[model samples]
Target: MDNINVSDPPARITTITSKKLSAKRAQTRIQAFLDDFENRNSTLKGGDKTVTVQLQKLNQALLDESQKRRKSAGEGR
Candidate 1:
């Protein structure tokens, strides 16, 4: 999904803006969010399996976005 540069997003929305985060930093942030979410919503169903699947999806998305950005930059040269 495209990132919206709106000043204020809806309260229910979770916006992840593009930033130059190192792999470690990204992992840390993702882990922190997952932990916080799990803690806040303890009764949530579908344990580790759900989280793993979501992480895999997120990793693939980041890789795809990176490749697209690289290709775009290369084409400009």
Candidate 2:
């Protein structure tokens, strides 16, 4: 071969989103719940409050994030 030229593209970083993190957390929670369900002394009722609080927090955080993204997007116009 006389001559050859080659070049590689620049690397780019990937971003993580809430949806994917939520899915992962859901899977982990299901696994934990299943483990608890198998225990003889497990009281699911006690965890209901905790779960409810967690859900509310997550919901609020997601809503806030969405609102921020919307405002930023609108401002771009």
Candidate 3:
């Protein structure tokens, strides 16, 4: 009789490489900052106009960073 040997497959590994981690951290910090600012000024009346303008600027910055990260990652592949 021949004996058969079986071994478990190698474990799959998932890692958020340093670059991706840094980008995610930056995104979190930006979001938190925006949230805190909004919370502090919640009672200001008619402040939506100013807040909306600021939000637009922040959104654009976030969008640009996201695009830059996507482009960089694509180039790496």
* Best of the candidates, TM-score: 1
TM-score of 2: 0.40
Off by over 4 Å in 2: 1-48
Writing each residue's lDDT as its tens digit, candidate 3 over 1-77 gives 76545575767999866454454466567677777877776756445557646765776677688889899999999
- State the displacement of the C-alpha of residue 77, model 2, in Å, after optimal TM-score superposition: 1.0
Candidate 1, residues 1-77, lDDT tens digits: the string is 99877898667966688668965556567667767776675756645557655975675566666678778989999
Q: Count the backbone clashes (under 3 Å) in each candidate.
A: 0, 0, 0
Candidate 3 residue pairs in backbone clash: none
lDDT of 2 by residue, 1-77 (tens): 85544575657889775454553455456556645654643566354456545655665566666678778989999
What's the ranking of the predictions by TM-score, best on top? 1, 3, 2
Q: What is the TM-score of each candidate against the true structure?
A: 0.43, 0.40, 0.40
Q: Which pairs of residues clash in candidate 1, taking residues 3 or more apart in a chain or in different chains?
A: none
Q: lDDT at 62 for candidate 1?
A: 63
Candidate 2, residue 28: the lDDT equals 57
